[model samples]
Target: MEQVQQRLTELGFSTGGVDGGYGRKTVEAVQAFQATYQLEITGQVDESTWGMLFGSHEGQDIAADDPADAPTADRLVELCLHQVNDRYVLGTQADHNNPDEDEFDCAELISWACARLGVEFPSYSVSQIDASHHAGLGLSVSDAATTRGALLFRRAGHNGSKYNHVAISLGTGEETIEAMDSKHGVAVGEIGHRFTDGGYIPGIQYH
Candidate 1:
């Protein structure tokens, strides 16, 4: 627990003490950290929190006001891009595939990145990207300027209401970072016209 507390402190969380217990102070500290990062105020150190402490996603912000502790956004972006060369799997947790190494899918990837950057973000469904009222902020998945760290959306057809696919904006204007599938792993692909929806949390930039 001392190690955990120390790690949390290094990640900018004020753990109050290096004690190995999750006491009220610890919970409050966790809640404070979560609130700052726009994460659900669960007051618990879940996988997402652990990922943040471990530096998996260094450039994305989980906290609205916290500036990235990372020296440069380019480093964070490069770290995320490096994972693109990895393999992808559906519905798998980021820590499961290789406990020895950190890898992720779309949702997990974004979540992990944001946590590390101390940015707050919400869990989202691929289909929710196109909903008239998204649970979070919305952006144009098809627009290049709006696609940076934005969620990519895809419809079954031109008139489909449900988004069947999702990806992360990689800032190429026409390409994005995606965890394709177990067979494909992770990679960058050109934006397809089939995708029509894009959304991202406002006031929360990925730099």
Candidate 2:
């Protein structure tokens, strides 16, 4: 476990000191890592994550002799994402919510996913928009046109203040993202139509 924590820390995850125990800090760090990689925020170390921390190295060693190509961070993130399901939880960093337990939100999910993808992001919903500003990565309708990796957004309530919720594009116009909500374990939703606000993030493309 200490090794795991060390590996995660070396990968840019704030593990709060490399300890063998899995504490809240470790969970937070793992969630942060998962967010960057666009993976499901489960907070629990699983097979996919192990592969991410270790398998990639093995793969590189095998490919070392081959002058063809090498694995990329984006590819690793995508692999991790596919290994997870879409579910949501509350109060837990594994779920997209205010770490303070204030509200269940999607930005947590986005932030976690982005972390796993090696992208730095703010941990709030509104901040997500601001972070994407001028970056051309804010959610948009045209994102639905693409069938592969795309970000999804949903508008809710009457006032703009009520508008909340965001998700990753699952290539089928479906609002499915690796979420962690209390009701659902880790699943996807239909953005706006079934859940609430819906749109896609541009510029920061995921493949």
Candidate 3:
């Protein structure tokens, strides 16, 4: 619910600050979003509404001047960085587990961020890396480090092992934003190590 509110707020509607309660304000916002996008007139978020809200951008790269507002990678950066001091937990994606606030695992951070852009990245690193390879979204570590909003990961032990973590490229090649751990939580940190797998959001028109 907070994810929906935060996302709605990011896209220009005001959900009154991700307060988690699905109040009248939220209903009005969702309804406005649906109306703007030419969706059915249900104020409630349904399957089609969820898709349009979070996964409809297949080919639209640049943000449209019209009703369809597909966010860019830089926009993604702004969203992630906005949650800098948020919590971190093992399995929560966005505000799924915590309604009053947001919490994330490494990949879930990317998953949640990508959701705002209409890209559905998997909730974990192993599948995410595999899907990227199949979709040709995989990037070399060096490329990923330099590509703002690219997801970076490091794998070990074997081919089938999941990458232990993931981080987002900050575009400078020297740093990244990450939901690091329980102790460190989400923070902007130096990209000091090598990565074994990585990818970028498909619809985010990278320059």
Candidate 4:
């Protein structure tokens, strides 16, 4: 069931995330698939739906079970929001290159979010590029940062050469949740300015 949900999400059908559970989102994904393939619009996974979905991935092996603590997309967003006022500490975690939530760095926040989902993400701002290579981790969002749980990235300094920063989407207009340096700490702020005029270039990762 988890594999099925994961497949639906990977195929861009948006089952919300592979938690092996059924809800309105899963039903909607099933209905959408049925409608797309001209299958009976039952909104239930029948034999035909299973066969088709399974057959489509003939060469791949679906996992027999999911990790007990793998966080879903919604949960990832919730966890990020839970740390709204965390102070920006430099070495809260032992590894400065790959810090955790308590470290309060931009990349560490993203890493912590992915870690909750059982996906490993480098906790350094510069090394965040590694996220693009993993499957079932998350999808890179180039334009749609408004989607909740999306991880937003911005290159910092003049001409974006100095460093990079990352944040989590609040899905509320152009706002984002992030630990914005020493003075601001962690809070929600307008993200649109980050991409306009001389601001940073915006990129996102959907967990």
TM-score to native of every candidate shown = 0.50, 0.45, 0.61, 0.50
TM-score of 3: 0.61
Candidate ranking (lDDT, best to worst):
3, 4, 1, 2
Which regions in candidate 2 have their CA more than 4 angstroms from the true location?
Answer: 1-87, 94-105, 145-147, 156-163, 178-180, 191-207
TM-score of 1: 0.50
lDDT per prediction? 0.53, 0.50, 0.68, 0.55
Off by over 4 Å in 4: 1-70, 91-101, 133-142, 158-161, 195-207
For residues 1-207, could you state the per-residue lDDT of candidate 1 as single tens digits?
677677656655456689799875466555444433434456687877656555566335533243446423333333344454354555656642342234455566655555555654444444345342355566665553344566666655555634356666655565565665565455555675646667663323455
Number of the predicted model whose lDDT against the real structure is largest: 3
Candidate 4 lDDT over 1-207, as tens digits, reads 898887676654556567888876576666545533435656699998887677864323221133345454444554554454456665344243442334476766667667666666677755554354233234334333556656566656735535567776654446566666776555555666463111111232333
Off by over 4 Å in 1: 1-76, 96-102, 122-124, 127-136, 144-146, 155-163
**What is candidate 3's lDDT per residue for 53-161, written digit by digit as tens?**
7886522323254235555776666556555546779887565333234678888877777776677668887777777778888898888988877878777653464
**Candidate 2 backbone overlaps, count:** 41
- Assess the local accuracy of residue 50 in candidate 3 as a C-alpha lDDT between 0 and 100: 83
- lDDT of model 2 at position 167: 55
Query: Alpha-carbon error at 67 in model 1, in Å?
Result: 5.6
Candidate closer to the true structure by TM-score (higher is better), 2 or 4? 4
Error of 3 at 90 (Å): 1.1
Which sections of candidate 3 miss by over 4 Å?
Answer: 1-68, 96-101, 157-163
